[model samples]
Target: MKTTIPVAVAFVAGVVLVVSFFFDEGTWVGGISQEFKIWMTIVGGFTILLGAVSITRVNWSAVQRKKEGWPYKLLTLISIFVMAIPSVLPNTWSPLFGRDVGSIYDWLFTYLDSPMMATMFATLAFYIASAAYRAFRARTAESTVLLVTATVVMLWRVPMGEAFLNMFPGDIPNWLNTYVMNGANLAVQRGIIIGAALGAASMSLRIILGIERTYMGKG
Candidate 1:
């Protein structure tokens, strides 16, 4: 009975949203559907709160037990409260500490968060280069094509590549990078996106029909 009610509500809401998208704005159903979307946003915020509670519960248990990595877990819990408290303060109160943008929050985000994000991406670039080097070997015709295409694309992107290619009469590398990459890459990307959308739609339909009862803790 519990699962049945939620499934019915989800099905009806899904139908309403699909109809609202295809119907004219002047229709009353469309307007009500838009209001329903706002409620969905509010529900999404609650989900974030739920996630925070879940994380805190797990980490606090670890801290209580003094488990391995307990110190890091404690730091994470402390950081969460430190970041959240000032963020929720009213603008009037914020001015006393300085504007949220100019406060400790901003300083932490700028110095701490920005550097951490930058370091992560910088690390990723080396990993990507290593993976590409291993994968782009010319062992097969397909791999050779991919390797050559990647080499041309990389070359045209930098000054040295362009300078070396400039000694040739024609701008073949530039043309291949611009036209071949743009045209073929765009088509492949679009196909993948459309396939993903269709897959999501199919899964959503199954959920709405209750054929996929996984969400309700059933088969």
Candidate 2:
């Protein structure tokens, strides 16, 4: 009954959403589709609450057991409440209570969270460079072409690299930007987008028809 109900709901929702696009916003199907979207947003809010509860339980359990790295888990729990509690309170209570500008939430996100994220991404740049080095080895014909193209693209991005390309005569930078980026790259991207769209459409159809039952958690 659980599986049957979810599948039926999914089918109806999918059909209504798809059919809604063909009709005007004032129509019955369109209204239902809009209502479904609002329901999805409400579900998303509940999902966030569920996630917070799940994380708190896991971290609190780890801390209670005195597991290795329990301090980090405790810190995570503290950070969650410290950030969340203020944001939910009334803005009139204090200047730092709500999520508005200059509030605790805004300050933490802008200063602490943003810098931490930037530092993490900066650390990842080295790993990306290492991967690029391994992938750009010119042992095969395809790899050699890829290596050359990557070199050109990288060079075209920087001032010194653009200067080096200009040393080779015949407007190398212009040619690369015109043919390689705007022409070849754009064409390949469009082809990939079309292929992905078709794949998504097929998957959606399978889900709507109840053929994709894996989402029910027991296939």
Candidate 3:
């Protein structure tokens, strides 16, 4: 009964949203659906405190265990408290002591967090390029066609690409991308969209009738 109510509500709302596009008269349903989403978001924000508490508990326990990078854990706790405590009780903003705690939090995210994520992604670029190079090698005629098409499109994506394409008679890459690659990409994307929509619809139907028991957890 606990899981049933929320799941039923979600399924009904999802179906209504899917149908709302086809019927102008059902626009009121869309407004109500959006309002429900806003309420859910507010409730979810409050519920997230539970997650914050859990994270703190787990990280603190790791530090107590004398795990590696315990110093980093200490810094994380400091950062959380620095942001949370200030935001809780109001205070003045200062560039010296640190502007708004929110601003400091934003700075931390934009600078420290974003750079770490970017560096990790930069590290993966070499490996991705190596993998693509290995995969692009063709053995069969069908493979050759796919490889050539992919190569043409890839070269056209850049400025120096024209240097490579100059080997061809005319604007071969532009013609291929505009006429050939564009059509193939669109067709493949549409097929994927249709398959995804059908899959979602089937799964949603099962959920609505309670065939999907995974959401029930223990019971």
Q: Candidate 1 on 53-142: residue-level lDDT in tens?
A: 998999999999999999999999998877767766765765524336777677778889889999998999999989986865899998
Q: Provide the clashing-pair count of each candidate structure.
A: 0, 0, 0
User: Considering summed lDDT, which 10 consecutive residues are worst modelled in model 3?
Assistant: 90-99
Top TM-score model: 2
Instruction: Decide which is better by TM-score, 1 or 3.
Output: 1
Local error of candidate 2 at 53, Å?
1.4
Residue 52 lDDT in model 3?
86
In TM-score terms, candidate 2 sits at 0.93
Per-residue lDDT of 149 in model 3? 82
Cand. 3 Cα-lDDT:
0.76
Rank candidates by TM-score, best first: 2, 1, 3
Q: Per-residue error at 66 for model 2, in Å?
A: 1.9
Q: Any idea what lDDT model 2 has?
A: 0.94
- How far out, in Å, is residue 211 in model 3? 2.5
Of 1 and 2, the candidate ranking higher by lDDT: 2
Query: Highest lDDT: which candidate?
Result: 2
- Writing each residue's lDDT as its tens digit, candidate 3 over 1-219 gives 787786787677667666666656447876766766788798899778988898799889988997999989988888787766545453454442343544665566667778998999998989989998787678999989988887777788777886788688977777877777678788898899999999988887777666775766733
Question: In order, what lDDT does every prediction score?
Answer: 0.85, 0.94, 0.76
Error of 3 at 96 (Å): 8.2
> Which residue pairs collide in model 3, if any?
none
Error of 2 at 45 (Å): 1.4
